[model samples]
Target: MLNLETLSMDQYSFVANAFSFGLAVMASTTIFLWLMRSSVAPAYRMAVTITGLVTAIAAYHYLQIMLSWEHAVSIETGEVVATGEPFNRAYRYVDWLLTVPLLLIELILVMKLSQQETINKSLKLGGAAALMIVLGYPGEVAETIGTRMIFWILSMIPFLYIVYQLVIGLKESVDKQPENVKGLMHIAAYLVVASWAFYPLVYLLPLAGVTGGSAIVAVETGYTIADIVAKAVFGLFIFTIAVRKSEAEAGASGTSASKKA
Candidate 1:
């Protein structure tokens, strides 16, 4: 069994700090949008509100991990050992649980902006999101760390669906000659695909013993950077598109009203 204790302090610190920083950025962006609710479109305002809540939850998970690390270091040196339970082993799964639903909601909202009318898009998205969350429970409750691979495989289904939706939206925007929408769609496509592609590679390779502890740390660092790029930069790109769309709609409505008068 691969032991986290075998890793150096620097390795542990690097992963923890990077993940914490990424989650912090995610949380801050969500909070910022929540604060500016009056200026955003109604759909986007709701999306941001959901994003804020999930981001805050994920941040709490990372914060708990950080505190656990601090406790571990003190214990190693014969200082008073912190005795409380660390985060539930299931918490990481729960973090993903919260994230997948918000992602589906965001995608559905984007699809609406793209002129796709489906009678049951919401129901489909919600059902898929719930399935992913349900599937996560087995991995969360597994007795050994090795069982996480099963979770990864199960989680990949929804992740791939999200990537597929983003790719289709990107292509549709490009073909339709909507420059603003195209730009945002391209960013979303790249971010979603890039961020999710690392999961299986990191977990599977480490479990297979193709990589050691340091390599796991490196993979984690890369994952953290990818997440930061996705949540911070790509998130802002989506926000810009929402604002531009609202402005265009407002201008068009004004023009039509004037012509009618």
Candidate 2:
């Protein structure tokens, strides 16, 4: 990795476009989820509402993120120069801290588990998600390899714990989901696992000998894409679960009415 106080236009263009694209994705998803909320049952509507809220938070943060990226770089003589305004990466961490726990809560709520189970699981999982984000930030800002490694290890304690809870602890709840949405729940859990896992790998780019301009581009682009999948696309999954469950219950109620008649 070359020292990159001044990035070539190619490098700067790549990251700028990434931030713009992420903003578009997050904003669009927020609107779409909210507009479609009426399609689900009242009980499941809150899940859809929070799904939109997650993207709304993401969209606002993405706007800040784009502005930060722009402020940090200047186009002069067709080159991208550092303007001495450091890019504020904290916007992303703040976004994650607010949205990650809600992401878990939305999924748990849409599952329609018993009230006690939903409360218990959401409280535990939400705390763990917040801890995971908090622990990862120190490593993200650390200059030394040892400090980064230590924080990375501390962070993974919560990350792996969340994954285990999803894959094992929540398996029975997921299995009890309506047959129509059961398979979808499984895919949603895996989507959370896969997309959330990408963050750690991106965090390790510097450790993997990727640095300078290339690392900046990779980190920005990689994170933008992951947020799209984890929030926007996953919001669609929650909407789907809500719609399917709503339809299933409606059909059951109609059948019960016919039998009574």
RMSD of each: 4.6, 2.7
Note the clash tally of each candidate.
0, 0
- For model 1, residues 1-261, the per-residue Cα lDDT tens digits are 334564566676677688678768877877776776555556466655665565666667667656655554433563333344442335455666666566556544643443343325555655666676676577645656667668867967975665666576336533453455666666665776776576556655545655555775776677567656645665666566666655555566876435434
Q: Any runs in candidate 1 off by more than 4 Å, and if so which?
A: 75-89, 111-119, 133-155, 169-178, 210-212, 255-261
User: Which predicted model would earn the best TM-score?
Assistant: 2
For each candidate in the order shown, give its overall lDDT on alpha carbons. Answer: 0.60, 0.89
Off by over 4 Å in 2: 1-6, 255-261
lDDT of 2 by residue, 228-258 (tens): 9999999899999998998888778986435
In the predicted model 1, the residue pairs found to clash are: none
Candidate 2 residue 41 Cα shift, in angstroms, is 0.3
Reference-based lDDT, residue 86, model 2? 82
